[model samples]
Target: MRENRLWSFLYKLQDKQQKWLWLRSCYFGLKTTGPLLLLGILLQGLTLSFFQPHGFFYVIYRLDRQVWVPQANFIIHSLSCIVFGMTLLLLCTAVAWYRARLFSKKETIPSMVIALFLLFLFNFHTKRMPSARLGQVILNGNIPFIEVLFLGLVSAYFYHGLNKFLHFKSLWSIAGATVSLGIVLRGFKHLFNVGFFASLSGPLFAEISSLLGDDQTQLGTIIVREVGRNLLVWLGFVSPEQILVAHTDSDLSRANLSAALIKNNLEGLPHPLNIYSLSDSFAVLGGYGQIMALLLLFILFSRYRKRRRNAWQNFLPVFLNLNSSFLVGVPVFFNVILLIPFLIVPTVSILLAAGAIKLNLIPPAVYQVPLNTPTILNAFMGTNGNWDALLFTLIVLLVSMLLYYPFFKVTETTLYRIQKGTE
Candidate 1:
């Protein structure tokens, strides 16, 4: 029974992998889809400009007029509905191509382009007519639904036909198709003012604010969600939250500190003081500094290994955090137990900083700082000239380095053992 269950699980996993691959292929095929979609958006923009008197100028105009602009609202709403419907049609077509086995078998760029143009024309004409008149002028019944359905069918047929014609047998061709589809969708979005993307912004910001609450939590959430999630996903980890804390207590403490500071200085504080600017310091450190450091380290290590080719036999694996690869491929993990210390060092330093702030040994961060500021600058700005943050960050860095030393030693030992075994 256990054996049967194991087989079933493996089969399910295999099925999911296959589906993911197919979707990825469609995402890649966009050299043609990109231009066509852009053209569609441009045309829509032109149409809006021509029909509306205020035109593109009104979009950015902030001045409020006392008079009602009925024509402007009518034009915007009608155009938005049509553009939205057309975008949906294109997206559905891409999804169909992604799922279709035939997508791997053909090249139908010409047909796909032609079909897209026709659909655009149909949508434009339909949108020009009054909404109430749609039912009266239908080929079958309900003109709007019929037009959408017909366009969808045509798009699917073209996609399938293109797959057969192009003979997209390779992985690259599938990738091209997916990219093309994405470009087309983006173009359509540009044409419509209806706010498909805008709709997402409010909800996304709300959710982010809810999760992060304050500046520090927001910063941590951004790192974990944006950076950690991307890294873990690349490493084949399914759930990012399992590896990183989605929310840190440090954020709440920081917010509380801000409130206390505001209360203490209520009478004398600058009226227009900006607290969020301090965040830029940590942003620059984590974003640019960390990336540059990692890249430089990798490049230096790679160059050094090139001089002694055998060095790569162990160095490459540990450098990638794939110690198991060095251990099994080169057999280094167990022998390189020192590497364990290096791994713990950075985490420990961060935890200590967090602990000190929590215990009030160090000040809780109060200002809302920008993410682009250098570490020392962030501390200075957040504390309004205080040097404690600068010192704290430097201490953390030193601790991290100390932690890494033991790990490097373990790595060296593993490399030596692997080399000896090979000899």
Candidate 2:
């Protein structure tokens, strides 16, 4: 009877695995378009980087001498013109088809037509006029209220069309599409002179021109600034000032002096980071640590499969870095008896380290660094040449691992008990 029950459970688990595999396969096939779209976007980015023209009137005054020959500008402008022309043709075709009632199936084409017409009306009103007097009229905020209504209509139509194309069925998809459309329209308004389908100048366009200063490097500077800021923010770390204040309670006088020294050093240095070589330290540390973690996880799984041991299943959550998955699956969720240490150990370890650093038991970490370059390497690089930061990160990792051990054992015990009960 026990053997039969064991066989039944194994069969059910296999069935569940098969179901998951099928669903994953279907999702992969459906998202195949994602890769092609990403490739196209990458190509566009590379073309803009190497070839695009710099400055205002790049499109209007293609004959003018530029520092870089504005070849990219011409290409982008020509492509935009082609896109605009094709969109116009497609809308006209759709309208004609609708009038003839030739195809009743796809409502998407008509929806696209409405979107294009609305965008056209917006462009018509906002476009800059050739005459100086008419340009001043637009500058003086004489835009009609009807034009504002058309802009709203344009936004709504764009949202609809994007939703149809992307097949956005969920609320998250709708919100994301709406935000993306807003950003794209804003880019168009700033980059190109056409306003509301009309040839007109607006305050936004004027601001862009003034800020960019007719320099060839304007676009490059913009790209660098935006990308650099975003990359820093994506990591958990903030600016040096923010990190110092949050992690230290040193006297204002001493803290300010230390920060100033670090800042000056960073400004004086020309290299990416003045400390240890970034490529050597980060590549080895992060690469090795991640690989070790994966290898350990694989070993645990292999052992479990061979031994048919329930304790092996307890490692799943930790392998995924969730920790709570095994606990909840084995129903350790409600048991406060084991939960306290499980949560407190890791939390306490991190907090203790932070507190010690604040109290100067160890030197405060100085660098604003990315975590991808092994934690230690990131810290060392951030500190402008301090090897001590690397050592500190190593200590912290050790403490964190020690804190996690008790929780791991508790989870394993729970899984074993459940397995025994099933038997």
TM-score of each: 0.32, 0.28
Candidate with the greatest lDDT versus the true structure: 1
lDDT of 2 at 401: 47
Off by over 4 Å in 1: 1-161, 165-209, 215-284, 288-293, 304-350, 359-361, 367-371, 395-423
For model 2, the superposed segments whose C-alpha errors exceed 4 Å read 1-342, 359-361, 371-377
**Predictions in order: lDDT:** 0.38, 0.35
For candidate 2, lDDT tens digit of each residue in 179-212? 5664676567655543553336567656655453
Model 2 TM-score, all chains together = 0.28
Per-residue lDDT of candidate 1, residues 1-423 (tens digit): 995675455445433543454323333222113233333333333333333343332333421252455465566545544544444355435533433434443334533443455444443423346554443321211122223333444455545654567766555674567456545654664545476665668788677555544344333443433343233322323210011111113445345445647685322222111112222222222221122122223234433353234334334222222121121221111122322332333335445654555454445444533322234344454555557666765565455444444334334444455467679
- Give candidate 1's TM-score: 0.32
